[model samples]
Target: MAVKTVEDLFLHELSDTYSAEKQMTRSLPQMARAAADPQLAQAFLDHLEETRGQVERIDEMVEILNLKLKRIKCAAMEGLVEEGKDLIDEIDKGPVLDVALIGAAQKVEHYEIASYTTLIALATKLGYTPVLPLLQASLAEEKATDDKLGKLGQAAAIEEAVQA
Candidate 1:
């Protein structure tokens, strides 16, 4: 991944995103289990399925581009997932834990938002018209997930306040 050209950069980013999506597929289930709120748990599970589709969309992009995907692990995603795991291990299961889970999930969603945004920009510059829709779809999903997590976090905070 020398990224000598715009196309090279696009492929590198796309491959990195592919790795990130794969990482999510593995981590989302664990997050779902860690969630104390049933809704939050179901949200994680729902996103797991969406993440799978996102991975498939990337696969489609690869097919259309006639490129072999580079085998690269997304270090950023690895770190994010590890941080979420740490939160789960440290926190007791309750509303507070559910709030924490929302925070952790939002962090991941934010990372994905940035990743997909960059991918879209690179794809546009590289004239990857076919993959633009795929990138945009993933971006929309990421944003929606972020918004959902934010609302969950807010509700948890309000409940905690009322209890206090």
Candidate 2:
């Protein structure tokens, strides 16, 4: 648990990411249900599936590295998820809520992007060649999800919400 080596840091990050993905898997359904926009709702559902896959990939990496999955709570993700839940509770279900949801979701995506970026670099430095592909795959998905959210924000949904 001490910050002794790169391997230790890698394991800590892996556990954090695993916890984040698991939290997302549980949170996405609520987000999807709260979304009034069909596209936004569907996006959350789609990302839920992607998050599940990401979790599996992390499990595979842990297995490959011969490391046991630790229950290290991702505090960042926990706070983000709580903020999202608060957003959902405070706002009425509508385009405005959808826009707010998109904002919340994008924050989650950005956190993931940063986490995976660090993870991929660390993996490469540690000679985790086989794990690179899995990390890269998740990175690409997170980027794509962020882009999708950006597009959703630019769509008429947010404008309508602002006017409403």
TM-score of each: 0.95, 0.98
lDDT of 1 by residue, 116-145 (tens): 999889888888899899999999999999
lDDT of 2 by residue, 1-164 (tens): 67689988998899999999999999999999999999999999999999999999998998888988777899999999999999999999999999999999999999999999999999999999999999999999999999999999999888989899
Candidate 2 ranges beyond 4 A from true positions: none
| Model 1 ranges off by over 4 Å | 161-164
Pairs clashing within candidate 1: none
Clashing pairs in 2: none
lDDT (0-100) at residue 118 of candidate 1?
Answer: 97
Which candidate leads in TM-score?
A: 2
Number of backbone collisions per candidate: 0, 0
Model 1 Cα displacement at 70 (Å)? 0.9
